[model samples]
Target: MTGHAPRTRWTLRRRIVAVLILLLAAFAGTMGVASTLALRGSLVGQLDTRLVSASERAAHAPTRADFPGAVGSDAQPTEPTPSASAARPFSLRGPGQDVGTLNLDVTDGVVNAGYLDDNGDFQRLTDAQATTLAATPADGVPRTVAIDGLGSYRVIGATSTAGTLVVTGLPTAAATATVAKYVAVEVGVAVVGLALAGLAGTVLVRRELRPLNRVAATATRVAELPLDRGEVLLAERVPDEDTDPGTEVGQVGAALNQMLGHIEQALAARHESETQVRQFVADASHELRTPLASIRGYAELVRRLPEPVPDTAVHAMARVESETKRMTGLVEDMLLLARLDAGRDLDRVEVDLSSLAIDAVADAHAAGPDHLWRLELDGQGSDGDESDQPDDDGPSSGAGSAPTLALGDEARLRQVLANLLTNARIHTPPGTTVVVSVRATDDVVTFRVQDDGPGIPEPLRSRLFQRFTRGDASRNRAAGSSTGLGLAIVHAVVTAHGGTIEVDGTPGQTSFTVSLPAA
Candidate 1:
């Protein structure tokens, strides 16, 4: 398998500066190369012009007496004039001839070549160098060639009227030096310009992006708020200067501000709707209790009447009493939920959770004797004694384990346990074993209720603690009625006490854990 290369996430500022520098360098390099080439061509053209003049002068200058030979002095016969120590000066070594100028004279298949040095001294060429110069055709057109001991030269050949061939050349050292120096200066200037451009571009880009950064900061603040429930005050907004809508960043800032305003209005509407619904449930539940209690009392009175009543009427009264009790419980649960939603403060007092767990398990066993119930402390089983049970005032310290204390309302905490146990009992079959446990850590006290039954359905696990979320056929095996608010009340109570609840619905190991701040 091929591995992907890691991508570098360069910020906008860095990317802009880098591209700017690269473009500047490319432009500078192109211009430098073009100018250098032009300068070299101009310098070579001047050398070629001088070469042609030198060739013409050599072709017309006076020659020797015996034959057309060396000029400028009175000396005649010579076989091979290979050295500059001749008594007579060479014909081409006259005035107006520059330093490092080369000449070749060819007559009757014989060649003589020499050059003038920087000190006005004449120097003879080696046989190899003379052969290279002689190869230049007498075509009057200049061409560049490299000699043995000399550097580059621009040479041209001309045929004199005496049928003698003259070749003249000049060294190209000055022009090459000029171009090299120019290149050095140009490269240095380009480097400095690129650096300055990069710096200026970075500063300008950062300054231009400041407004976008501000908009992002505002968005980040809004994202940190708790907008999932309750009355949320969305007061964060982009600054007015950043919301001009004229530039790109400004347009983004303006759009964000508009979106935030819309979200604030939506949150306000949602809070208002939730408030009205909660108020209605509270009022209705309050109005329901009196009538439900009165109906139950009447049914009980009729069932215990002194006079004889019909057996059918007696059975109907019993059913009515049972239904009334169920309705009363439902109303009470709804009222408690409404109060919790309204953010009512609960009594914060220290309570031993280990003793509370033991008492709750005892009560659950009494209520559901068909299901096996067990109590544990810190993961170890505990045979809870009556003496350790909590009294009407509060929980008593239980033996066999240290008391795991938590800060919460005692009555609400007790109700939390009762609801959890009732949910397990009403949902699972008779053979299911339910375990209740309490544990404490340095920061929190934990209460866990686990049942070894068929796990909850996958679809229901997400909203299991939401109100009126009943179990499906896989878990609802028992005939006992379920109003579906048991887990909801447990969750609401835990949250009101500044705690958290979580569930694990692994098959045959469903568990709910509540964590509260330790006292």
Candidate 2:
């Protein structure tokens, strides 16, 4: 099963702003709720005060007729008339009266009341409503009462002038409307305030975090640099002003700059060491060539001397010649590597790789008769098509001409194929099958050397192409092997031709692939 990629997370600026916006929204909501509640209580309190004042006026209101005795709670009561206002008692209600008035008469052991509904019509209270209103204590303090068909009211109960229990009330619609208006206003203001806060917060936060972005941008640039191999020129660094050590961002930039500086110094030292090594090899190869030639000449001269030399002396001279030849090959390989490191130019010519692989495999078969060798051309034909065949000179001598060609030094290319074949022959046991396969496409060419024998061990394969790298005593060399520089020389020459080479080895199969760009 395939795993999904990780989700991209929010940026620091956006995340921080989101949290801030949530906190502000919560604060605004809480404040709006608190404001609405405070305003509701204030409006209710005012309405209750007005109700108390109206009740006081009705409790001692002017009587419709004269009574024989002072009216008190102890005397018999009569029905009470509802008033329009405190100042204009018994006056007809006008447009100014938004306050609903109510009067309840609890007299003669019965309860009756008349209250104004929302339509301004005088509505007689039901017996239950009257009883509920009359049951309020006659303490002259305001209390809440609900009359059917209307809404809630703030009412005050008192003893009327006729010694009956009377209650005066005002519907709480005005106070409720005032509270609602405040709530609406609060909502509008809260919305606008939160919107403005979000916009301003975003802009300010982005500006404040720009320094951190600068630091991050520098890090990204460093990450993109190719610092894994070769001479690393780390000339890039945080600017001087950015690298000040005072602020947080400044301190980070300064520290990064210091680290980069150290890395540059280390790379310079490493490059210096490599340069010294290359110079020594080049100078040593040039100095040793003459002596090696002299040694070979002296051995040949001593071996060809005129009369019957002892068999022992002849054998010693032959050994000296062989050792000189091997040393000469080693010196040549080292010199080639140094020259490649110095970037010496090579002769570039159109060379056919199919011809080269065939020639090299033939040479390998002749040299190691115990091993099987074959060449497989990978472009146009593998079954000896007339067009892709090679002649005595090269692949171009075929009936139509070979198309699998590359641009490189022909002698160097031949040496590379020869070395690969030699490595395969020497490493594998007798009767091993070795194949040199050539593949050519529109933009590139590949030559793969494959063998079926006891393949290269995993542990030594990684360093197989390094200078002086050799196999174990049993697998390193065959009878006529001169030096272990075969694979090393192959790698150096391939790289100098601007190509690549790699090897893959297992128990029963091993393939070395050399890829070169097409000319």
Candidate 3:
């Protein structure tokens, strides 16, 4: 089997134009061929009619016997008397005989041929040309023959009253020239006509397809919108002019408009549903916090009562208190997420990222003393205050030496760092080394939390920051149970601050990076 390459697909405009041109060319070609053939046939027919007439005239013409002092010879008289000159045969230059008229008289196998020149003078034919003329059958029917130097002729043979085979012809040069000129003119006119037609067709086609182009532009704009989340305002629609259902393009435009309308309604319904759910979660979280606190307080009271109680009861109260606190934390996380989803405004101010990193790492160290903690401030290890550092606008060793400051809600930003550090501490095994780094550039501030431990499971990486997404037992080695909302909160807070966060988890290393616009 042989393979063939795929042909390139042509656009609608190109295809339409090409088809139009091809059809025009075919039509023009057909007309040209028919016209040229008709013209050539008519010219040949007229020339043959004249040839027959000339042959008849030459047959009846006066011969040498009719002239005095000229007898039994095919030569003209060199010094003929006035009477003999007057009796000479006049058919070659006679009335209605055009230039280049050929005449031949054959008597008893002797042939004599001559033709009229352009100036009406008689010129004898060469031997070959005369022989060719003599071969014309004396059937009184005209036929075409090519003479050596005289070109082509339409010749006919007829016997005269005096028993001479007379052949007469007219050169076909004028007819051939006429037909050639007609063909040239026809071709030129056809070329110009096709060119004009092609131009007009292209303009008309483009004008007719304007509605389709506009519809495509509308679709493109709609596709560029961010419709994945939030309240999407699907306002893009094909224009009214383009949406008519009368024609093919109009029908397509109308259908697309209808589809867009349906999508808009569906999106509005979805957004409404999501809004209701968020409101419910927020209300429930807010309403449950006080009761949870009350329950924890009662549990504590039961444990510290100055009365004899069963150890099992005390242990049960402790467990109840722990569970209540955990529940309270979960409620708080949900409420915060709801607020963020609602696009609640937050306090924005310049906060030192370096200081935040130092505090977060120190806190992590306190919470998980079993793990090794490290901090890098602009590639220089530091666990100290950055408040006393020189202003970034002033000269410094490098840009990284400047305090990394970002404009955002201080509390939310701090929480972002806390969740990241807590995630690292809880997921990795004991004795794992965790690093916190902060760096500054003219445009942005960036921080990273990296740990050398069992990396996140591959299956959990895609939705690692999604709410309620928990790592499996292999990645979670801390004492506390996983609530799975820590990274989710981190992601939400960072996004709310107009920042971005990403995680890279390999076999033995995990790193989280956050970038924020500089203050």
In model 1, where do residues sit more than 4 Å from their true spots?
Answer: 1-6, 65-91, 306-311, 378-398, 473-479
Point out where model 3 deviates above 4 Å. 1-11, 59-93, 104-106, 131-146, 156-167, 369-372, 379-401, 426-433, 451-462, 473-481, 504-510
Sort the candidates on TM-score, descending order.
1, 3, 2
Q: Go through the candidates in order and give the clash count of each.
A: 1, 0, 0
Top candidate by lDDT: 1
Candidate 2: TM-score? Answer: 0.77
Model 1 misses residue 28 by how many Å? 1.6
Is 1 or 2 the stronger prediction by TM-score?
A: 1
lDDT of 2 by residue, 421-514 (tens): 9999888998787777788888899899998888888778888887777776456565466467888889989988899998889889999999
Which of the two candidates, 2 or 3, achieves a greater TM-score against the reference? 3
- Residue 14 of candidate 2: its Cα lDDT? 86
lDDT of 1 by residue, 436-503 (tens): 77889989999899998888889999899889888854555333478888899999999998899999
What TM-score would each prediction reach against the true structure? Answer: 0.86, 0.77, 0.80
